[model samples]
Target: MRGFDTILVVDWSAAEGVRRAERDSIWIGAVRDGMAEKPRPMPTRREAETWLADRIGSEIAAGRRVMAAFDFPFGYPAGFAEAVTGASDPLRLWDWLAERIEDDARGRNNRFEVAADLNRLFPGTGPFWGKPHRDRFPDIPYHGRSRDGHGMAEKRACEVASGASSSVWQLFFNPTVGSQALMGLPMLSRLRRIEGLAVWPFEPVDDAPAVLAEIWPGLIEQAVRGREGIRDMQQVARLAWAFSRLSTAELTDMMDVDAPEEGWILGAGHGPRLTELAMTAPDPMADPPPAARAPLEPPPLSNDCFALPPGVHWTPVDEALDLLRARLSPVAGRETVPAVGADGRILAADAVARRANPPGANSAVDGYGFAHEATGAGPQHLPLIAGRAAAGAPLAGAVPRGQAVRILTGALIPEGVDTVVLEEDTRTDGTAIAFNGPVKRGANTRRAGEDVDAGAVLLPAGHALRPADLALLAATGVAEVEVFRRLRVGVLSTGDELGAPGVDPDPAVTYDANRPMLLALAARWGHEPVDLGHCADDRDALRAVLDGAGTDVIVTSGGASAGDEDHVSALLGETGSLAAWRIALKPGRPLALGIWKGRPVFGVPGNPVAAFTCALIFARPALSLLAGGGWRAPLAMTVPAGFAKRKKAGRREFLRARLRDGRAEVFASEGSGRISGLAWAEGFVELPDGPAEIAPGDPVRFLPYAGFGL
Candidate 1:
């Protein structure tokens, strides 16, 4: 008993002969007293337009609120083209004017001018300008224009319909056209035939009766209870009764299957059943229980434990980062060094200003000045005095009452003087000065301690030396500063297969790119890079070289994998300790993070591309953390895909890509091991572990080079 009571179906075809064609007619069906009904068919557009106007006008006159749903775009007016393109052509006119109006409103901030322009271009006395509403629809869809316009109109209608006045001027449109218009505007909320309900890019059409019945109940309830004054309550009741024949909830169950977890609720009447279901089949979408991780234990450092292969120990990424940070702790002790000119740096100890920036009161301009009390309100020519004060020059003494002193910029103002009259603004009378303008107290004066008060914090610890800092330190009379000692990093390119530049590479060896890259990176980070000669394949030799390198950190390449030839892990076990050797990421999975002789060391993969990727992802962040700088997450942007692809789940992957037309297109060769792939890529497209496959036109997250520590 939930079907529409009154349904008016109107066929909006142009010819009456076409209206007779049942298939082409737009029907408006109504049930109880024009409450709700199915749509009827109308063949002619003229008939449909007349019927729609009459339906809207009648509903307004009867004081019965009607929600008129239209198939065409209602927000954009027909004359909107002239407003958007600034072009006037009858042939290019659209049936809807809302889109153009919205564009105009957004593009111009002057509402008065916009309204005037719209009025002049689209002049009509009808509900929608003088032109027929259907003639205003756009011929071609502008990107997001239709959708944006519809959303704006819907918000306005909903607000008025639910406002304090209970206004009856509410209108609704389904973006779907059918015979339902005949039921009049009252049936606006009853029409529920929408296509692709669960999928995106929804298309609107007259849904089947079976599907309509499922949505009819909600539509009827919303219409009757949502608005006041129904023209035909009896018809609505009958329609509702007919709709009850089908179980509306069962057919629409899929629509609510993936409803968001936040707004979901179980019926109070079915509490017991809900409880049983909750206990038997827990929802995966529900919140999960928090996991309690085991406390970390420091690696054992006994003489026996360092004998050969060290036992494997697992640590969380955060904990491992913390350990590395503590090992590479910044120098706390500070030593004062002579600060000369622009060479002054911030002291480790907080410094207070020994004196004010200006040292004393000063004159900000060159002029004849005197105390306000000394010069009366009436015009008087004061005798010219011959006292001079320049920057750093102390004033000889205060000028007598009617006498004025000459002052210059940055020169300390004499005592008992409050105002200064510019030399050009006065006519000197020999030994006396005459001023026509009135003078105010404290004018043209720079007070002592105005810029920096005495004993104020001039510079703080850990602040880098800058030009301004040096000037302020000089002004404060500080001769030296104390700063934290810079860290020294040892760069080692491991493996017999690697060779330094300038040296001729053997037929079987490759030039070591890691050494130069690491050297430049360490220098950029304010750390001194000490290159340790490459280690040979022999494990004992590698261990000896690592132990002898006297550096805060030892960054090496290769010899970290489980292969017998990879001897860096064994060397670390013999020297210090090995932390983690593998990570849950692509391209750089074979990364080795460890410590050597109390110094942090990173063993990157042998592949040049893999080595750089690992450095960007893990090594850079670890270094920043060790330098007392917090870790910074990379920036992510949502972009559309220019191509389609399917990816495996469980492991996150980064694809090299270039952005074009606001869409990201993957590079031809994105193999992680290929150095050319990394070189050609403008940025990386990060794909998370999920079952969703990417399709062309689908939105994706793009990670630019700056976002990934580049």
Candidate 2:
């Protein structure tokens, strides 16, 4: 039913050196056309990357769609992207780390040092910790747990869900998994960027032909019910064999989970469901949803006033973005415009070079043109040619023997000339030029097609054009460009107590903050923000405004929570669909995600602080998706706390704070209604997903408002 025809599974490792006999070397297993292939093992990570690339490329060439799963977390904790790369996009984090990590074909590596470098970027000791080998890194510990002077001692959501999966920060400790993440992520980054390969949950569905997701071998181990295998390769083979045997319907359902940012483990809660569905054959005539499909039905809502809705699960912040990402499809309208006028537009299709980079051999430097062998090994003088060749002009005849042409930079090399002598190295008279240096053949010239070959892709779809990219388009002779239509976002505000900012205020009313803020933010991010204006708690008035707005997506700032005045929920329940509400977040718990009249509707909390937080955390990424730019997690950095604080367990919290003298200082109050707190604070310091006490120097994740496009 789906497109995938070949499935590849990798049991990844971070061990260094030739590991042919080592038990932890990388192992690869594949399934094609119901056949289980023998698992292959590689002694080094380099060889493993090469092998998988070749195999996947070959399968694609044969007209078979492939699904590749690797055993590693595709992303770090949510704030990681903003802190490390100063961008909210998670893929940028991958590219940043990939550029820094060095992997050789041999087994040698510096994974420990890499982890230490990453840890140093945060405040205090971590977000990443546990270094058992050396005491060189003062922030990291040589044990599994964090001490009073260190970071939080907890696992990520997916790690805890796996039951037996190790923490990604444990490097060289009791359970050493830190190396795998530090080393493996770089390779995963390389794999994700492959032309036709797409990394699952992170890359938008339209980015690639095949999807790559995270896999946990423990899921297979459970599926087989602890079947014994002589070696890890044998175990991998068993896993691949099991995957190959699943029916198309079962496999499709298993991979249908919403996992946009923090990837879902395939066969994870659905092992039993898959087994049950496998017995029923899929109808060939009924077309199934494509890969990376969104949930079709709204999850049930709970009747409780302030708690989570019934059957509505509270996903991790990053995982929630993934869900929103699935429901969003890029806007389809496109326009062709002159390349010079397409500066900040998203490319609607790939741009290919029509001609080669250098139509012929051209000089790289300004020098005398001559054949190197024509002169002896020592410095020699040659007669000056009759003509001079400038960058745009060329000499019509070839250089004669014992003669050289006076050439300028970028000029095509004359026939019979293989090298160029620098003008500074030669003394030229009226008829003769004296060479003062030994000349090398084939030097100072750029060969044809050296920079860019004809028919090569210069840019891909969804690329936002930059100044340099415009220059490149000019160089490629691209006169007209195709780009996606600009996204039109509608901003709505609902509350009886709110008034417009510019007008004279009523005695009992507050100036409407959410609409103006969201409008300014949308405009700043290059979207056309349509102000749908404000409505009281009246549902009919809200519906009237929404009907007339006629924008691609809608964002409302009040009436999303569980109060009698919360008409946004009632309206959506009557005429639209409500997907989720009451996320497990502090100051922003009462958020809602749904669809209205076939368009996505995001409901922000009534309190200005919560409204701002929800808009930044949720609405921003959703709009980015519709703009064809894909999802981006807000950037978060680890900074030391300048003040002490304690919070209850279970709920994630964001404390408005300012960075001062290398530490994050929280605002005096935690009330969500304080509008000045949002103004006074430069960013937010995030508490973990449980009860925690923060000392004056504890490391807290600092999320700058700028990272969210505020």
Candidate 3:
């Protein structure tokens, strides 16, 4: 009723297995206030569920009412639910499907078999139809037309009103949404159980944290039919934008429905409203909403922002990440810098293309340019024009009939000339040129906006600029960008026995590796490294360094545990802000997370290897948010295991590993004292917090060192 603080539109995929970021995969587009996040392509329903669930929880925690729509009917034909589940309530159908339908990340399911079982229970030919094969499905029909006497309405009342052509009975083929519903309903059932989450039409949604709804993107076909890129992506983006722009009263009317048995689409009877709203969707190329440019300084962390969730003995990787994403707000300040100087800086707002690349139609080769039609059915010859079009120059006038002009790459094609022939393909004399017949039309001609369209969004907010990205920004005529200031990270290492890198240590002591390594890691992540310097394990001394740190956040090694001499953590605990997550990760512990003087402090373990691993795996993402860049999850790939191991649940392990024969080989020793192992391995093989008896061919997640940037 409040028009939702956030709107997410999903185009669910019905693919049987994990898919890539391509067509036929799930795509989600979202709008918050007046800004839109880049569409996300999900490879599996499992991932989509996790992402959707987490986002809902995160939004609710932030006190934002969310409207999440999936492109599938929420209910079947009116009587179908009663006939199948013996209940008129649409939720009953969702529960029944949740219990009967089985789906997995690998894209295998028993939907067809489940449908076959349902058909045998119903009278006559039954309602469900369509599958991947031509082979007969004794109970399920190949086509909806082949079925009869199902004793159920072919389409729901809302479907007919909304002009949604594909009925729930058509499981596949002809732009059908049935399979998506069958696959998505189980996830919906899981979501319905979330606290403060409600289903539209079927459940009253007053002041709910989030509302789940069935949306037919085709309700406003004109809005998405002509957009570029993937159709599914465009549909969700424009639709979400349109929905987010609606007024409270308008949204109320759309939601004022009573189709408990046949759940209504959000905008089923408001087609004109949808069309009208689509006409005014925000332009991508234009400057985003002012809110998109976050304030130069971020607000302080909310109460209990760093407090760990209770009832968890060991924090898992996913829980840690979700907590970071939900609670940690960016603390970095903002600035506008020249595009060239914006290297490695996270965008404070989206950077749009000021102009298209290859601003005009130009020649792509140094050859003859003329009307493609001039090349008749046979080998043709034409007189060379007096003028030439070279790179950075243009021909004065259109080429005359039966004439061709010499054109070099990057030169604008003259009027009336739409094609070019490579010099090697043509026999050119001093005054004329001859080429073969049947030349491809518009060949070797670079059209305007071929690489990038004018006003297109070049980079989304929070994207860190890379060297290659600068080329794109420059090509698109972006002069300067709004970026977050580099975070000032201070590193403090304790223990009088430790010495600096170049200095020799005492007989019983080793040179301090954690401090320098942590500082360098912070620098590599585009932060301003501040050396807090080493100090002995005096709580008063540590407190003094932290008080005068004057940095955005601080990182400390050693003395983080709860032992008597663990001053770093003791100081934080005294301040009532310490949360030793005691995370269940190898080489990770007492991830001393706390806020001191309004700045986050990370106190890692003493062991060099443990400090490095914990900093990379746990502190990296948290620090990213503290720096005003959004949480960044390290990229990981699945590779076969080159070694065998038996592990118990409760602890996640990250083994220093390298890729060999396309498999991940862990370091020789699992010992945390082996600091040399960190340098020996190229990446880390992460084991989940589940009992795993891994063998040689088993798959494991490999996180490359390069993926972390730092």
Model 1 agreement with the true structure over 303-375: per-residue lDDT tens digits: 2321222453433333333344334333222455766632423234435577887788888888877877776
Best by TM-score: 3
Winner by TM-score between candidate 3 and candidate 2: 3
Q: All candidates' lDDT scores?
A: 0.48, 0.71, 0.82
**TM-score attained by model 1:** 0.47
lDDT of 2 at 401: 74
Q: Model 1 misses residue 283 by how many Å?
A: 57
What's model 2's overall lDDT? 0.71
TM-score of 3: 0.69
> Whole-model lDDT for model 1 versus the true structure?
0.48
lDDT ranking, best first: 3, 2, 1
